[model samples]
Target: MRRKSVVDTLREIRLLSELDDGEIAVVEKNCRWKTYGASEQIIDQHSDSNDIFFVVSGRVRVVNYSLLGREITFDDLEPGGHFGELAAIDGLPRSASVMALEEARIASLPSDQFQRMILSHPKIALKLMKHLAYLVRTSTLRIMDLSTLGANNRVHADLLSLARKVTKDDMTAVIQPIPVHSDVASRVSTTRETVARVMSDLARKGIVERQKDALVVKDLERLEDMVEDVRGE
Candidate 1:
């Protein structure tokens, strides 16, 4: 890709979205671009790497493996998203492994350069702080779900969190790109068979409808109530 195009892509990232062309040019100059094939490892958990990664194209998943070798997915990031900021900010080892879900393009900036960018740009630093805060909250919520909720409830919560809000005539919402059962299982720390069973039960009860590309919550209120019921139990 052309240098100008690379700069433009960097500008589109939320962390750098507000940067002026001159600032973006500076970032573009410091970044190193790399591509990975499908299912390739981008970063290993606990590895010492001070560079932060920004996804330019395609998808990647943040994951960790259990002692027994089970894979737990933390998040799926697409273009305009980023990872490794935690390590970059604190100079620690990676908290989780990153893998390309498909062919992907990434831009990496060394920790020192990233720190300089943040120090020179207060707004960017504030954005990074806020993003880190959000990640912390998400992690806390996941821990709570795992500790207090059953596998079935965890599945419900996971799907609800992934769903997009929409209003059709009234205010109805649906989750597009309904995740595969195996993916849901990984996120919820359950077996795929359990996810499939819970999904089937929800479908039979008319709480949710599974379509080709999406999952429609026929009764949003009921679904929410179900989640609450699980939480209270």
Candidate 2:
């Protein structure tokens, strides 16, 4: 239900929210859309790959594992979110793995291609750097939370992140659809059972509504309050 152009796509992500008209034009000219099957490995962990991809449709799970075989989720990327950005910019190997959560369509722009597009646009590079810094800080906070918080706190944080992307008013949040419940569990560092219970509780309280496969959050203030209480740790 969203526009497929780079401008509309950038509007959905915080990083490119501030891009100017000229910068947007450059991105539109360079991005190329591609499709992937469900369960495909979009990017392998520790792989020396260098293309940044935007999810235009479908979902991706950014996951990594610990020495003890625990899978930690860095994020569940939906439409309008991007991955491989840090590696593409810094020439580093990918730090995490990305798998398609469903049949997906992605727009990928490789590092060399990105550099060619922005060759004369030094300001765009600076803007992107600033954006990546924010992601690092955000990821660190989630890591810290997972180390210290319980299931409730983790779920609360996840909801807050979802809330930020959802175009909503006082009573309805239209979040992009996400399948693969295990992906959510990984990001929260909890079991899927816990997420299910919490969601059931929210549904009972009329704070959320199931829209076929996706959720429509109906009470933003309560969701925020729950996260605030957890953060009070």
- Top TM-score prediction, candidate number: 1
Quality of model 1 by C-alpha lDDT? 0.85
What is the Cα-based TM-score of model 2? 0.68
lDDT of 1 at 53: 92
* Candidate 2 error regions (>4 Å): 1-34, 54-58, 67-70, 78-81, 105-110, 116-119, 171-180, 203-219
lDDT of 2 by residue, 60-96 (tens): 9888888887888777788867888878878988898
TM for every model, in the order presented, reads 0.90, 0.68
Q: Model 2: how far is 117 from its true place, Å?
A: 4.4
Predictions: Cα RMSD each: 2.7, 5.1
